[model samples]
Target: MNSKKMVLIGLVLTAFFSSLAVFELIPGLLMAFLLLSVGIAVTYYFALSRMRLESLAGISILLKAAKEIGKESKAPEISRQLGLWAQRLVKSEAVLVWWQGEWAFGDEEFTAWPGLETAREWVKNNNEVLVLNQNGGEIFSHPWPSNINSLLGLPLMVAGEAAGILFLLNESKRGYFVPQDSEALEVICQQAAAALNKARDYQEVEYFYKEILFSMLNALDSRFPGFTGHSQRVARVAVLLGSKLGLDEEELRILEYAALLHDAGKVFFLQEGLPGEAGELEEMDKELSVLPMEEHPPLGAQILPDEGVFARICQGILYHHERYDGSGYPEGLSRTDIPLAARIIAVADLYDALTRLAPEEERLEPEFAIKEMKKTMGMLLDPLVVIVLEEVERELDEIT
Candidate 1:
């Protein structure tokens, strides 16, 4: 029968016997029997009530603990929360122990606890929870402190593999943990395992994304001559200039992207039209050279997606060759009418080209290249951009 019903039946029987003794002539013996029975029933009732209350309290503690654990996204936070909850539930100290390829607790650096290595080895060997008695006196039982007689350990399992163990200790020698206590702890461990796995998966996905982006950049480099290291260099220079110009993070990112892919449209341009071939151009070749040069900027714009940062980069690509005096092709936008990214790239592209070798001749001496750049400052280039280039040139010389 249910405990409540059994308690009620005992109380009723006690009352009936008491009434019988009181009404009968044979008084003393029956009266003593009735008093003993009534005392036993009352004591049993109180004990059962306390047990029920403790069970309910245990359930409430676990529910709150599980809810808090569910809300946490970090492993250290989870461990701290588990420690706090165990302290509150059992009125004692607790520790959360985890093992991967190595053992650890929270985000703290790993240190070997005296018995932990042994515990971990045992779990790995047997794949089960280990509970020990007090006094370190038990063989075939997990170890517990003499001061804290009760100890409970629950295995954290994922896919039937032991991931870690949860150890709860009572400072006062409460009786050994009941089956219900172990059951509640097991549920908490299950939730923790799931959370850890999710974090691991997220980290893996992030690494994969970075790998993919770098590989794509490498592929683009392989297809274009003299373009292998160009994008990274441009990005670095653009970011430097963007910082000097007091651009915000978002603006800096756009400038960097534009610089990296400024010649992306050239991917579609004829290979023979590269700057290296400029010296080899025959009189008849001028027509072909001019055609590809005129088409690249617009074609680059068409190659990328039509919105956001990519679109902005495309706009920059389309106009990087445009001149300040309306002499440039595709569109003759002059001076401030051109986008800032295109203006910045115009200076960078020219500097790189002038300082590098081409098919016809060796790269120009720095002094001669600077003089040529100064000549075109207000007509072919933005006057401010020319000033910035002069400063950058000085810095490069100092570093060299």
Candidate 2:
């Protein structure tokens, strides 16, 4: 029976004996028997209740940890946080977690106990919880440390496979951890495994998306002779400038996509009269560049998805060629009316065109290129964006 029921029974017996004793209807020996039984039962019940409360408190902490773990997006970070939570839940002398071939928490300092390798192998092979007591120091693989007498190892199961193990250690208090501790730890490990799996899946998806983006950029570059590296160079320089200006990751991403695909509308302009080969266009075809120059920005915007994250990129492309002095084509947005991303791309696009696309003899040196760009800062480019570009150029010069 549970402690509550046992305590109730003891209380009833005591009341019955006290009533009998008061009326002189019970013997002294019988009264003594009832008194001892009541004392033992009440004491046991209180102790049991305290232990149960402690377990509940531990479980509560674990639940809070699980909620926090779910919000993380990386496997190593999830595992690290899980280890910390596990340590708090158990109040163990040490807590160590191993996941994805790396120690997530409680490294060499906490793992000085013997039989760790044995415990790790057991959990890995059985995919179950393993608890060990230093009974006469017989259960340890090495000479048992005098301070530590018990260890608990729990499997972190993910998708029917063991993802890792959580090891908890206790100081020389024999039988320090009970079966309930193991069960509570199992609950925590299950949540950690789920969080780790989710982080891994998210990372894989991000990697796949990046691969596709790079491939598309390469295919677009192949369409223009002598422009195979132009988009990538622009992307690199634009990102540097964006970083210098303190643009956050999301803003930098938009700027990057806009710069890489700024000239995408050129692909549509490859009609019968345009020289379509990979080399620089012949003098006769130079006039054809003007045909797309007027419409490429809008056409490039139309080439991307119309809504969602790419919308910002589309806006950047559509206004990339617009000038600060209202002399640009299509919409002629002037000054701050132009999007910042487009302005940054405009500077990057001009720099690459001057250095990489100009005829060999006509190409200017890096120092001269900065002077040429300085002439149109307020007229053709955003002055602030030009300043950032100038900083990037200076850094590049120092590096070279």
Candidate 3:
């Protein structure tokens, strides 16, 4: 109830009980005692109600923050964003995030605090939220920072398993971290724990997916020592060029898949007949059959599942060898008629093919690579793709 209504009800109860004692209708002692007792009870109830309202307000903030972190599906990004949310969670100036019992990111100075290790251990082992203050009895043997009067540590636990902890140091406008502050942090921690677990699962699946692709590509390249690593580099550079060209998330996903699987049609000729167990595939280093090199594009397209998501990916893989000027490939697709993903892979594939022939230290310099790349910009590769390649090369140069 609102304070005004509560007060009105309290007045009514007091007046009713006071009249009973004043008139001495039965026994004055019991009547007076009842009035006093009722007054105390009403005041206590009012205090509890106010606290409940404040707690509700805090819940609102917690939900908003949790929703923001929920949208991310990558563990590192989730942790980075968690640090930002931590400061707001408890109105702290600095926050340190720990994962797997080690510092992952956030304020480095929190690592300097003497009692932090002890505090963190307590939190992790107990899987609970801890609020510490210099003025309170929980004060540690080591001195605390003068400006900082309080500390809060919360473990990120899911299913009773703790993966990380959040430590907020030296609270600001919110005063000391209170029960409400720690409670807010706890809610966000749980949400983050779930997100972290999901992100990790996604990463594991992605790692295996890429590993399988590399295995197939390895089998295809087993015959040509100079051409080893060609397909992987093409996939890497294609994604980089695609990103530079402003392809959105889905486009990049398809582009990357197509690039990785572009040479997949040649996998069958690797003596094993098909890409087998990763271990078995690695051991069989037999030479590839002398198949028509130009046939692999159409063969790759046919091999990939053309249903749902892989449909566009297959098309891209199928026509990666097609040229911009209609002078190349199995279908002679020209210019934009070639799928964008294929066009991107085409540029990346040729660039890597030209440079990956030598050992790393002796490989063609990017400048020389680009000079060779420009020779077939129109006749052999997508013209626009080569332009983006130039920018990709420039970026690499500046980075190196």
Ranking by TM-score: 2, 3, 1
Best by lDDT: 2
Q: Which residue pairs in candidate 3 have backbone atoms (N, alpha carbon, C) closer than 3 angstroms, thus clashing? A: none
lDDT (C-alpha) at residue 114 in model 1: 43
lDDT of 1 at 58: 81
| TM-scores for candidates 1 onward, in order | 0.43, 0.48, 0.47
Sort all candidates by lDDT, best to worst.
2, 3, 1
lDDT of each: 0.62, 0.73, 0.72
After aligning candidate 3 to the native by TM-score, how far in Å is the CA of 224 from where it should be?
A: 10
Please provide, for model 2 over 254-281, each residue's C-alpha lDDT reduced to its tens digit, 9 standing for 90 to 100. 7877777777766566543454567563
> Which 10-residue span in candidate 1 carries the lowest summed lDDT?
281-290
Better of 2 and 3 by TM-score: 2
Using TM-score as the yardstick, the better of models 1 and 3 is 3
Clashes of each: 1, 1, 0
Whichever of 1 and 2 has more lDDT, that candidate is 2
How many steric overlaps does candidate 3 have? 0
